[model samples]
Target: MAQTPQQRRANERFAKNEAAKRGRGSTIKPKQVTKSPVSAGWVVVLAFVVCGGLLLELLRIVPELWTSIAAMLSRLTG
Candidate 1:
């Protein structure tokens, strides 16, 4: 079956597009990942600071725990 002029032009345009797509190589470039500004030494220091804070908090709670235990023991004895 003979196509209309418009249909023929559309088919030609489609084939030309397909050929153009096949003729080209990949134009995409690889993405580069950026490293963090903070170094490993800084990370270690931050971890140490956090751990030191936790240790100090634990130390602060120890005296309260001892007082509570003493109160319980006195109540039990009385």
Candidate 2:
């Protein structure tokens, strides 16, 4: 048995309508409020500490930047 093109089109239209109806009535999520001052301060402090540690580790591996600081000064003087 072969399905006609009209039947397939009807089925596709029905599926689209079903999806749109469900999307409109989807569950709503409550807004998240970061209202804790103590926890927020700790979060900001830890972010800076982690970023600073990674930067130092990169500077250790790429020591040329540290050494180049002296070279740059010498070039300026020369």
* Pairs in clash, predicted candidate 2: none
TM-score of each model, paired residue for residue: 0.55, 0.34
Q: Which stretches of candidate 2 lie over 4 Å from their true place?
A: 1-38, 64-78
**Candidate topping lDDT:** 1
lDDT string, candidate 1, 1-51, tens digits: 999999999999999999999999869988999899999999999999999
lDDT of 1 at 44: 99
lDDT of 2 by residue, 1-78 (tens): 887999999999999999999889778899998677578779989999999999998988788886899899999999
RMSD of 2: 9.3
Considering summed lDDT, which 10 consecutive residues are worst modelled in model 2?
Answer: 33-42
Please tell me which predicted candidate would have the highest TM-score against the true structure. 1
> Model 1 RMSD to the real structure?
4.8
